[model samples]
Target: MTAEIRLFPCLTDNFGYLIHDPATKATASIDAPEAGPIIQALEREGWTLTDILITHHHGDHVGGVAELKQKYKCRVVAPHDKAAKIANVDLRAAQGDVIKVGGLLARVLETPGHTLDHVSYVFDSEKALFAADTLFSIGCGRVFEGTYPMMWDSLLKLRVLPDDFKLYCGHEYTASNIKFALTVEPDNAALKARAEEVTRLRSENKPTIPTLLGDEKKANVFLRADEPSVAASVRMKGQSAADVFGELRERKNKS
Candidate 1:
């Protein structure tokens, strides 16, 4: 059977996920911002925290790591390159590493863009991605530490996944992002439709994560590196795909 996944939103827009396997009584937390909400969700669901998976080292992402670790004594997993950034790490690996949560397994993806230590956890078995901040609902994370090319390459790795894969990202920034998407892809019927949907979501105060990858490919302006419209929008005086991606990212940052 598939794992039971519960999302508990913490901080302003950050999400902490609980992946539970009823058979083995194993549970894993994708990220921890503050321990209180995580503990609350676990208690509400009657699940023990068996492991903690860290996606990055940003304070908003890892603020409660020490407290959670102390409380659950859970095994902590993180990217090998982020050792200097993350506080504690019981296990570490580069991209393409797998960490099993009972019957389910999550593949490690080194998605450095939001931060040099950033990563996104992929579970092809279940078609879910704990895309910390690199990939959001309609928007992507701001470039904090990694180069634009590095971030674009990281997102490209994820773009090839199955179209229907459930994209569970870290924040809820769909409405505004899609609105900005239209500014760049004005003639795109799919993008306009998505913008309307996202606007409705925000108006209703609804959740906007776990968005579809196929949909992102159609609506996410950043992922459309080859699209003439996006390419034109990204074109500086004159540049390449990497430069275009960076330009698009900067435009999104202001939007």
Candidate 2:
């Protein structure tokens, strides 16, 4: 049987996802930053929560875990490294570990950057990536706990996935991110088009989740690692790849 995914936006921009397997009628929540929203959404969808796939121990990512666990009696699958902080860890898994929710299987990806203990949950059957803070819609996560290279490598790993893969990032920063991209490379046609489109989408009070990897590659300045324009912009500062990437990221932060 096929699986269905539902997106629940919560707390300004954070997104909590529900992956439901029709085969077994099981549902898993991808990072429960808040219980109220998750609980409400699950109730609306007529789904029962069976598990919580924690990406990291960030408060915004795990704040509602205790309440949700108590309410749903759901299994908490946290990364092996963040077990101590994730709260009520039912299963501790490493990178490449496979976890199940009914007929749906999620492959763990060690994507440390936003946090030292961050991980991503990938469902191969659906080509869906719950990248958390590792990779955003039109931007990458800031380097908080990891260095440029570590984040870069993590992003590269994500970049290799299928072009049509659905990227369910942790936040909705696309509008601001696209604004920053324009400041970085004003001449990028794709970036210009995407920014206009994002403006329209935001105006309609719609969600801009699940951005395709190909669109990010073409429009996202952070993902255009090998483009001549980005390289030239980076080289103008007489810096290394890491330095340039870091600078661009810093610029985005300030923008």
Candidate 3:
């Protein structure tokens, strides 16, 4: 059976996700920005969280892990290299590891960029990707601890997935990302249209997440480093894709 998923806002811009497998009544939270909101969401859905699947060790992502673990004794799962930094992690996972949420299953893909220990979870059967901060809507994460090439390689991993995959990133950064994306691919019709739609959505206080990989391929400038237009925008035309990507990341850092 397909897993039921719920998304809610947490902290200032962070997003919290809940996935439930009805067959076993097993539910998981992708990241815990805070306990009160996650707790409320669990209660509202009548699902007890049995797992806390972390993508990275960022404070906003793991802040409420202690509270949730105490309340439900949920198994805390995080990246192996950084598990010690995250409180209450019961399992340390790396690339190729498969995690079970009741009857549902997800494969871990190590995607380092925003952080060295970053990883993304892909539930192939459900076509859902808990990308966390690695791959956001219309943008990819900043290369903080990792190099630009490392971040570009990490993004390439996701680019190979089926275009229909749904991306559930960790924050509500679409509007701002779109704005920055436009600077690189001003001629992208799809990007322009998506920006207009995102503008309307934000004006209405709607969430702009769970974006389609297909759409991002066409609209996200960070993913379009291979495109001539993006290269031209940064005056790096004819450069290698990695070089173009590095330039784009540099521009966004200043943006």
lDDT of each: 0.83, 0.85, 0.91
Can you give the TM-score per candidate against the true fold?
0.94, 0.95, 0.97
Ranking by lDDT: 3, 2, 1
How far off is residue 91 in model 1, in Å? 0.9
The digit string of per-residue lDDT tens for model 1 on 190-219 reads: 788877777776788777777899999888
Query: Candidate 2: minimum summed lDDT over ten consecutive residues — where?
Result: 234-243
Off by over 4 Å in 2: 236-240
Give the TM-score (vs. native) of candidate 3: 0.97
Tens digits of per-residue lDDT for model 3 on 1-255? 788999999999999999999999999999899999999999999999999999988898999999999999899999988633887889988999999989999899999878999989999999999999989999888888888888999999999999999999999999989888887778789999999999999999999988899999999888888888778888998998889999988888899
lDDT of 3 at 87: 76
RMSD of 2: 1.6
> Which candidate gets the maximum lDDT versus the true structure?
3
Worst 10 residues of 1 by lDDT: 232-241
Runs of candidate 3 exceeding 4 Å displacement: none
